[model samples]
Target: MSEMFQTYERQYQELVSGLKQGCVAAGALNEDQRRPKVPELKTALDEGDSLIRRMDLEARGLQPPQKTAFLGKLKNYKAELTNLKREVKMMSMGAGAREQLLEGGQFTTSQEQRVQLAAATDRMYQTGDRIREGKKVLVETEELGVSILQDLHRQREVLQHSKNTLHGVDDNIARGKVIIHNISRRITRNKYIMAGLIIFLLLAILVIATGKRHQG
Candidate 1:
């Protein structure tokens, strides 16, 4: 269990790092959802989540199979983060108080109130509650890290089987892309060949006609 906690602690630290980066990146994204840059930022954020999920798997010693599930969850979280970031940005723009719809009133910018509530939530609140959902997620992520280590201890063979399945799918997709690219190249080559042959035949006919006219 000590090993598990160690793994969990490492993963937690990595997640905190990612969260800090995410906050900074969130500021780089457009404040308005209507902007074209918003989608680009969203895509970047989604890709970031993918990186984080893969990193988490490496941290947990879970290997590969679970990576897909975590990736799926990461994608979901990316969507959530995008929405949250967009809302937060909108709030920054002096929009109305009800963008989030989480609580009845608009969120106040009183840094003291925000700090005190945050402290209270950290100290006395159940991590699972809606008010402290982020904390709950962090704790659960640690539990997942421990669970993954234990799983590796007991059911590694089964986990590897899952890993193989996912890897197979990933390989097939890569192979499919290569095949499609080759087919496209072949079709283009054939088109050029056909065009070249048509031009050659036309030139030959013209030469023969000129010789016959000269002989006449």
Candidate 2:
């Protein structure tokens, strides 16, 4: 029973850590940053959940799983996971809000909303230029339309790459700060230890000198 409990706790912690990473990845995606590791994160989350479930079954004869500490934590983790899943959904939505203009009643993330606006602009431009010329306009516009869509897609790709680079820089800066902080802490501790050692050495010398004088 104790061993099963230990396994459940370890699985639970792993799940929590994975969820945190997923949540960060989701947030980074919200910034239109590409997250290529989302699939692996999903796998980790699934594996963690499965491990907990397996442990639950294993402890059936030895203990009551429901009343165990693991269940309580698992429930909390589920709630956190629910919120994280919503964040992930919103990240994909890209544009989300109340808009009567949407033929489909749904919210989209801000990025999708921008893309929708761009599409609307394209449609409007095509409608206005339709009467200017016949075949030339049709051919020119067709090529131009394809070109515009391609450019937009390419621009988004570039922006996502830039965002990812920026995120990397930010993470590096954060890690640097932690490293500096840890170094400072260690230096301070070393200073205190050295001072204590020096004081002890001085006291020992004084004690030996006093003993010699008393002997004299």
Candidate 3:
């Protein structure tokens, strides 16, 4: 069980690290490169989703709270990926359409293109917001993990103390048994000595009485 738990933990950590790295890479891109980076972001998100599902299925024995939190994280990651994909596709289509509308050297206003552009821009901003929120979530999760570790440590200490106390009690009980046995043996020996002394005294009294009779 411990081995399985360790394996699960290692996979979880690796997945989280990959996600954080992907986010950092996304955040570091310049404006000109963001659209191109969308493909990479989607790939990362897809991999995350795949891993999450596998973990969910394999680690079905997870406690309810952990499973709930895991599912929540997966949902957030999946949603962000979908939003980014939509934004990228919209922007790309708008760009292509605008080029085609640049007919006869007159590239003027197109309402549909404008609408798509606006929507794309909104989604872009939303994605940025989500990225920041993801960072916050990661930080909070790390703190929570630390707290859990501390609690485990405290519980281990308590168990160790209890074990020591039990050992001491066992040792004391053994000593008490030995002492009682010795006391019982001594009492038995004293009984035998006491009987012998009484017998000797009776013999002496009888001998004295017989001597007195002879003298009379």
Instruction: List CA RMSD, all candidates.
Output: 25.8, 28.1, 11.7
lDDT of candidate 1 over 1-216, digit per residue (tens): 234434544554465456546556656765433333333343344444444544455544544566455545555555665665565355344223223333446545774475455455434423323434554466568758876787787797888889999999999999999999999999999999999999999999999999999999
For candidate 3, write residues 1-216 as lDDT tens digits: 334544644665576566556556755765445655655555555455444444444344467876676656556645655655564454334455445655546534675566566567658856865875676567557656866787799999999999999999999999999999999999999999999999999999999999999999
- Global lDDT of each candidate: 0.56, 0.63, 0.63
User: For model 2, what is the alpha-carbon lDDT of residue 51?
Assistant: 55
- Model 2 Cα shift for residue 23 (angstroms): 67
Instruction: Assess candidate 3 and give its TM-score to the true structure.
Output: 0.45
Error of 3 at 216 (Å): 2.8
Find the 10 residues in a row with the least total lDDT in model 1: 93-102
Ten contiguous residues with the weakest lDDT in model 2: 92-101
* Residue 87 lDDT in candidate 1: 52
- Which stretches of candidate 1 lie above 4 Å from their native place? 1-159
Q: Sort every candidate by TM-score, greatest first.
A: 3, 2, 1
List candidate 3 segments past 4 Å from native.
1-121
Model 1, CA-based lDDT: 0.56
**Candidate 1: how many backbone clashes?**
0
- Compare candidates 1 and 3 on lDDT and give the better one: 3
